[model samples]
Target chain A: MPYTSDKPPLPETPEQLRVRIPGWGVDLDPADRPAVPRERFDPGATGAHWEFPERQPEERPRERSIEHGTLPPVFGTTLPLRGVSGVVRRYAYRRFSEARAAHWLLLMAGDRIDVVESRVLAAVRGRPDDPVAETGVRSEVSHHGWSSRAGAGRADVVHQPMDPVIVAGPWVLGGLAAVVVARRLARRARRR
Target chain B: MRAMVYRGPYRVRVEEKPPPRIEHPNDAIVRVELAAICGSDLHLYHGLMPDTRVGTTFGHEFIGVVEQVGPSVERVQVGDRVMVPFNVYCGSCYYCARGLYANCHNVNPNATAVGGIYGYSHTCGGYDGGQAELVRVPFADVGPAPIPDWMDAEDAVLLTDAVATGYFGAQLGDIVEGDVVVVFGAGPVGLAAAQSAWLMGAGRVIVVDHLEYRLAKARELAHAETYNFAEHRDVVVLLKRVTDHLGADVAIDAVGAEADGSLLQHVTAAKLKLQGGSPVALNWAIDSVRKGGTVSVVGAYGPIFSAVKFGDAVNKGLTLRMNQCHVKRQWPRLFEHVRNGYLRPRDIVTHRFPLEDIAEAYHVFSAKLDGCIKPLVVPGPA
Candidate 1:
């Protein structure tokens, strides 16, 4: 089976959830009064007036297994490079270029591959345990935002929003240098 | 145009909703003529199915006159009367090729668990059903079959889900020439299954239900022995006693999650929604069948885990078979039966309500009121 369903439901607001999951049959307030008497029916009588299901709706057993989907957050970050005479710059360029190329390929393919550990896989598989239970993100983010997870007990699963300019600068410089190098080689070949 | 929108648990209202339009190339829009509130629809109405969103329409068993058709729709056309199978199966899939239309792989985005089911919440492909003025049918040619010229609209609609499911339940029992079959629940599906059991050559058939009206219907319609579980001190013990303590050769559970058994279990599971559903009828079916007997389950239940007697079933060496019925596969044989006067599928419909008054129809069916054995919905003036 696919780890997680590709189709996630539309976001259900609290307003909708309040009425739906409460398990109360619209008894809090009768939305509409029945024009016909709420009289019981006789098994043999064929003429019980039904004025459109104006009554409140209730839930029954759903045969299929569609549950609330919890998706791992997808966010991006950037890395800054400090280079003397573009030495480290060239090294960072190769590494970051690989990452950009991979990103481009996935975008072209119009699909995403989620690679997580078995623990995270449990949530995707719709099994009992979930990734959120393994890691408490809400409380961790509230106090320090991104720095708390980096503290003593946990040193992983940090969320730091990085400026895209850092990666964009080196990428642009590398592209310009490549273009210059290509032009010179082309000119030399033409002269030869 | 009005559709029965499910707002919350046990709360249904008819609201003006925009009719469906063709969203895919193989899709066809059917202006629903005759629809039925299926027993399984109660599951959605009660909020047992997960991800059953509000604004979801609930009828899966419906017949309609085709209003519009996408370019790729070939089998059904505009103005044609068609009875759509509850399953929205793509014809060319690994499962569909093997005639397992209910397990078709290429339809539902969530194909891992269930195939496409119309109006059956998001878990079953999230396809909208034919309960409204217009419904979009996917893979239209494969799923919707033309109504046999001589068939009644009521019979055709029932075949879309309940009748087909009941017959499939009997077929899964693998009934032999003289096998005794005990069917739990005398609802439309149970009645149909008991009747179908006879066609499958079962020598003796017994129908069990808590309702007097339904048990009486079973006695009259299927000509089978009837047992009122409400009357028996122990229904399972009584089944064993009546079957010479060997139990019946086959037992079919036609009652799904909402079945009543013990008060505590029913309160927690069916009422509280703690577990899937009170596994009362299913457990009884398991216990009532003979050792090494076949157990066929057609009753609809929530996908969540339930406290079932799996250990006992394994120890008894019983063969268990179940699925959402593959409706198209049973159509040919059912058509023959209907034509030959062997089965009057339409005779079960006890009440009919306009699409405008579906809430009352649902209430009548859900409450099992006024001997509403099977209630059919009239969508438009047809």
Candidate 2:
């Protein structure tokens, strides 16, 4: 059987090219062309990608202080302690995302490819001035495919492929569980 | 231990790096004996692939002798010579279960997008590659097969990637007897694909490339017709005319992201790094293939969007099949073909460089200098 996709593939008529793929310049021939105007590097990626939303400005510079919080209600604590644990968890999650996005690796010669912690990569990157900004090369590299987890790791996932399914295995299981719960509730209501 | 590291675009250097160690139960450390620089690696060299981190090494087509095996590695013991597929698959995922090892879900954290590839870039699971003195083979039991006594190391290394990918490209064509196949790109993989198409009962095969040297090599190695796209005003139109105005029965796009075409497309995509390298070759494939024909893409493209003629493809009903070749699935047939003398994968190697001269090797290959088609890299002074 031929493969089919529910989400229609890209379609741009010769005349409607401008309307469909906004910002995609007509010039596609490869020649000695001038540098792409900086504004042309739209993080929004209108042409090749139309569905992805623009990234928040705050996410660009990786210097935001993560407000790591802790539980203030140890034995009924003070005002400052409220929601502290949740904040800590959120901070931890962001750090985890950063670590995943970081290309820091642990390897000997050629034995294998494994990831090291983000802090270790940060230390190495610190010496050379943050390599990202230091390279001074800016292009609208964006998240790939359909990875929601790619949200914070946009730098890493931009070039990689991704499936649209999110936490697919667990998400499916949760849906199944909800269906079962709903069925059980319906049965109880009938009995009552 | 020393290995090639990506310093920047068009810059590479051999540097001392820690040797690979077994980090997983199924991992095995192999001391690389022979490594071939692949055409796709050029994409990395030219800074086409995104997330090609500076420190990352970039050799996927390689062979070596195992020096150590982790506890769970049972198929091969230490001190065995083996060929590892470019793919690092868990062998138990939904994709791997069906022989689509290239789409293995467990190995690469970015598996949602691309499969785990050894030593291409951080996009490929950040696995250090086999261009170094040592490399770790993950899922060693499932991925690395012992070298057949008759197969040469050079041929075995090719099977790991280029040769197999080419063969797979032909297979994707669904070629019937007397089919006319046209391959765009005369690089190593393109040459291999064209040659393999002949093996698949193609009555005619044509290779297209701008470089006279590469086209000559394609003619010589693939024993097929060659077309210099640059010499013609519109190569696609010429292809249709030559194929009786019906277009090719099957078209394979061996050139991926860094394709050169019209001046403006090259500037916007290749030079500007705006969209994934211009979809020139792919568009040509779509334009040159007959309605209801198959177009197989083996070229390496970054995940970023490219402005391809998807609408045309849909309207034409072209069966556009492509993937990073599942190397392990192609192994059985490749081995038989090698044993039967149907293929000599090593015959494509045109240059050899010591590990220390990798920078020069990269430069030579990148510049297309000295009629270079494929170059082999030795891990040590050779």
Candidate 3:
């Protein structure tokens, strides 16, 4: 079943409606852009956490400010993303306008593709007060195809991925290419 | 009386300082009424400034009533309210003749780094700052902007660095009507960048930062669309998402550090981790820009060589422009903007502290506590 908004819907603010949301909205180039499934994404096992690392206290550290110059990275990653859950949660909240705009980190571990949807479900099912603050997602009863998970902990949540979505794009694309090429080679070998 | 002495590295003291008197023909001795702790001043505070002479006064962002002036001084008279240009220029050199006062070679020959400025460092012409009760400003006619009768000194203090830097970014980026501009690092410079971009006719401006309070303020004050970088890992992708597949026409990097490296690390670390002077955000800016776009880096850079892949920038056909803001050239227009109520850089100030409470002020600014954007230091009674 296609996912639908589960909350009481209201009119979008002028800013929200006029906002030029690229990949998610009217400007989305359908050929290149994937259809975002409405069903609740299940974070089957991985639970992502936004870790705010504590900075060591500087008691009386030297305060010399230096002139930082800029060149560019010699061997930096072409990929721009870093944390996985961070990006997913960011998109989930952004696409679903009703969700609180604050940092709602996605915590999930599952199949790479599944985790994306799961993270949004995690935000919706568990985040009752904020209700994932989605715009149109709240209009339907079973927006995620699954009722809210109650006390869903260890059995469902895991942490191996640590925001696995960071590598989702490249990893998924690379695997698909490998499978396609492998199939072609297998077909040639069978014909010979 | 002794001045607040910069004894050595990591050492400065407010000593019983002798009062300064006008020295040069165009000099003016002014009693500093309000001197704020500047982000640049933190360089001297942390003893990061090299070859910095001890016993030098250190505050530069200040407003005061001119107490005395030299024979040649005409623009400012005694008892007139004024604020000195942080970028102290001769106002007559070849560079100054072209309105590039920040690059006045005569005032700062060794200052190949930044044209020249008061209270910065040897690289900035090594003049003492206004942190002291009294400061002597040279080339007074060409540099200081007279405070208007109606303007509040507290609000006007920002014109010194923050607003000037913003104007510089907007000017260099060539902000035009209906343009989309993105300013990275919503610090004072970024906020100023948004304001200036709007003033220059950008149809939409987006400010990216990790701090929510600052983003809120940027949205409220600069009339910009704010993005929380903390929320998205791929800033370029997120920005592209917002700008209809074409990134901002101009992207300004107000933050000037490697991804996780700093100027100090490059200076001291044996076999420096990186070897060319490149900022990580510059690459991000490049990626965040649309085709044939420009990236303006106006952030204060420290002396360090981190390797930058020039090939990528070149191949991308990106035009990277950077310079210490030429304040003298743009100050008149900026000040006019302030006078006419067309600009208000003061909206960024979330905290104000007395000079006596210096430590607390630093704490708030450094910690970014409570939406602290611009922290003003009141040297004396407000």
Best by DockQ: 2
Q: Output per-candidate TM-scores for chain A, rounded to 2 decimals.
A: 0.18, 0.20, 0.17
Q: Which residue runs of candidate 3 sit more than 4 Å off their true CA positions?
A: A1-192, B1-13, B257-278
Report residue B109 deviation for candidate 2 (angstroms): 0.8
Tens-digit lDDT string for candidate 1 (B251-347): 9999988786566666566555666677888899899887799999999876566789998799889999888888877787778778876678888
Task: Summing lDDT over every window of 10 consecutive residues in candidate 2 chain B, give the lowest-scoring window.
Answer: B104-113
Tens-digit lDDT string for candidate 1 (A95-129): 33322333222211211111112224435757423
lDDT for residue B73 in candidate 3, whole number 0-100: 72
**Best candidate (score: TM-score):** 2
lDDT values of the candidates? 0.65, 0.65, 0.55
Q: Considering the true interface contacts (CA pairs under 8 Å between chains A and B), give the fraction that model 1 also has.
A: 0.00
For residues B44-135, could you state the per-residue lDDT of candidate 3 as single tens digits? Answer: 44334433444456776888889988776767888988877677766554455555666654454322345666666543554667766777
User: If both were scored by DockQ, which would come out higher, candidate 2 or candidate 3?
Assistant: 2
User: lDDT of model 1 at residue B86?
Assistant: 93
Evaluate model 1: give its lDDT: 0.65
Task: Find the 10 residues in a row with the least total lDDT in model 1 chain A.
Answer: A71-80
